[model samples]
Target: MSVIREGKVKRVLEDPESSQHVIIEFTNFVTAGDGAKKEELEGKGRLACDITEFLLQYLSDKGIETHYVETLEGPKIRCFRAAILPVEVVCRNVAAGSFCRRYGIDRGIELSEPLVEFFLKDDKLGDPLITEEAVMRLQLVNRSDIGFMKSIALSVNHYLSELFAQQNLRLVDFKLEFGRTADGRLVVADEISGDTMRIWNKEGESLDKDLFREDSGDLLSAYVGLLDILRKTDPKIIPIRSEEVHVMVMPKEGIKNPPGEVTRKGLIRLGFQDVKEVRVGKEFKIVLTRPLTSSLLKGLELMNIKLLTNPIAETHEVRLS
Candidate 1:
């Protein structure tokens, strides 16, 4: 559990057996405006975990491949490892914050469509938002990737805006991080907690950011209230029942065969109270130039590799080969 990187409210660590990625540990200490100031709030981490877990499950169920993997040790959420992009996506549904201050827009005024903005990942530079041309000129990300990321971020805001409205909350604006997975899939990677979004109650009272910005003295209370609203809205929305399993494969000739040893550790590591273990085996690797889809069954049959396993009657299960 050695710390690999520490953020304002979370620390990331490499899983001992898996050198390819790390696990994030959300902390109770919250911060804004980079590391300018920090405050300790009791139960902040738990609330973040609970809320983020719910949103991640909901979004994933709706076909969003978020970085989330599972929750371990009750409150901690496990996620698939990724290489974070050096950009922060700020999706705004209304004019507020610096937008109102700098551009003289009225607060709470909704935009016709959600505006997707990008900020260079440098807090010391005051996180100035840049245009799409500047983003590509600076080479922060590939042009195509940036386009895809913006599309996904806007879609996420649309989905969340509606979801929060159901709970009588207005989704003003939020920040999101995207990362490339081991398989090169770009997915949302950061924790979507109260710290990252500006949520307002039906009465237009602030529920998230204002508590921190204005030092409202009821920061934790506001967070708990938001959680209470969520709980009442969907108490039965438990952690997702993961059906898909992932396995890391390498060339057998050059790499030392740790299949047996890795398999044992994986079994124990993945054996959560709710998860079940299935059989494991070895097979040759198949590389596809494009994305794999359900329509590619004929191509898969030609390859002669077992790609999937029979569904087990358990909450979760994994097989490594």
Candidate 2:
């Protein structure tokens, strides 16, 4: 593995097996106070990794593509290669924290529209939140990109708000990042950990940032307790695919128009053995003799299926006879 870059909590490395990307090793140190102060909080890194993985999986299921791939080791997360944007996208639906301190807004007051803010990723300057004009003046990103990012960030916050509400928690605010892949597609990047979010309990008690601010001296313990509650309340399991495999041939365009036998033959020529005729918009099932491989995944990508949705499987199981 070749070292690409090292940050406070993660290190990027070039994987020799694939030229297309690198992996990120998540670290154990937690930093606050604009990176001026650092503390080795026990289990902080693992907690972050777990929370991030959960959020990434949830978002991906809702048609959002994130940089997360999988966990490599105990607390390390592997991610695809990308050029990271140097701005933190903050989306808030309610007034809290800096929003209240800076603008004299009442905490917990809902806004008519979601507020999207951008902050430069400079720790020395205390990561001051700035306006889009300031971002353009500094040449951080183009105007069009900023507009697109704001739209996407608002969409993300809406999605997350609904999701957490399902879990009986209020998502006060959160930060997001974006990265451009090698193919020039911009996707949501970075970890969505507890540190980057403000989670509130049913009683409107702070479950996240209050640990750091209240001087309670048991921040890590409080975080772990919250994790335990989450695990017990909303455990997730990946469903096992049935022994019978289902394969469907979806046309690139209209489903109402039926393809001729020659088109079916072409599908057979394209390595789709046992192609069967079926009614439009109906599913067909086929049993597979082997599990899917990386090559097959690449073929699916070439067919544009990967770009249409997240390609990473939530869980993979193999069968051999």
Candidate 3:
């Protein structure tokens, strides 16, 4: 097979049997922080290939066009040849990781609505988020193509979110890439596995690349576990509806509130001397696929006390909807 191209974690080769197809080989190579950190884990490539195959097949069965044709030998797959786009599409269901850092919001805050974003696929520039206008101006993709990608990305997010929720895992966020075939058809290309997505268990533990990025857990073992989950997950399973749990954090009555007092003074100084008081509080909304049982509420309350508030000076209220 003649080589078509090579990337950090995978290589593409021309398929001798069909000129319209290519063979993609996943490598053990992994990187994080824009390739500032790197490592090779044994069996990681095969695990990635299997995970991608499972997900892409699920998507294709859902009537989404993808480059995936069939799984070949270990760590390899045959796919239709397409000119991969130079844009990365990201869909976020919750506030976490770079989303929190970028927006200065606390992690774990469930979004009121899912968000889709675009980034230039240039590693040299840290793949900074790009606007649709910028994408058009840069000629990276046309306006219509942007709309198509955004729509498909959201659809993928919806399906993947339901799939993971069934397995009791939260699909926090993921990145996707699309390409155009010789017939000018837009199809999802590249891999979708632990490396391309962020998944968290019910306890908010990372099951994706964050373990490798943060150096806090075993990457290979996590990937293996993810593969097992995907292998058993039924793409045709009915989706479980998620319930919204809202948590409100506020200062305890009679507690000294220096920040609140400052805000009150500022509001009064601006004009209204009748400004009586000001209180600052935080609100968090968490979505759960499981029933809101007493035990679950206890766990959430414990989490609030341990991580969401100062027990001595703050109180929290939990409500379900």
Model 3 / residue 119 / CA error / Å: 0.6
Give per-residue lDDT, candidate 1, residue 226. 77
Q: Give the TM-score of candidate 3.
A: 0.73
lDDT (tens digit, per residue) of candidate 1 on 4-114: 888878888777767656677778887766767688878888888887887777677655678888876635667878889989899998887888987887889988988
How much is 148 displaced in model 3, in angstroms?
0.7
The per-prediction tally of clashing pairs is 0, 0, 0
Q: CA lDDT, every prediction?
A: 0.70, 0.67, 0.86
lDDT of 1 at 35: 65
Clashing pairs in 2: none
Report the lDDT tens digits of candidate 3 across residue range 1-321.
777887888999999999888999999999998889999999999999999999999887766688999999867999988998899999999998889999899989999888999988998899999998999998999765776677678778888988898899999999999987876678899999999999999999999999999998999999999999987788887443455567889999998888989999999989989989998888998876543433455678798978988898899877543
TM-score-best of 2 and 3: 3
Task: List TM-score per model, in order.
Answer: 0.71, 0.67, 0.73
Error of 1 at 293 (Å): 11
Residue 181 error for model 1, in Å? 1.1
Q: RMSD of model 1, in Å?
A: 17.2
Residue pairs of candidate 3 with colliding backbone atoms: none
Q: Which ten residues in a row have the lowest lDDT in candidate 2?
A: 312-321
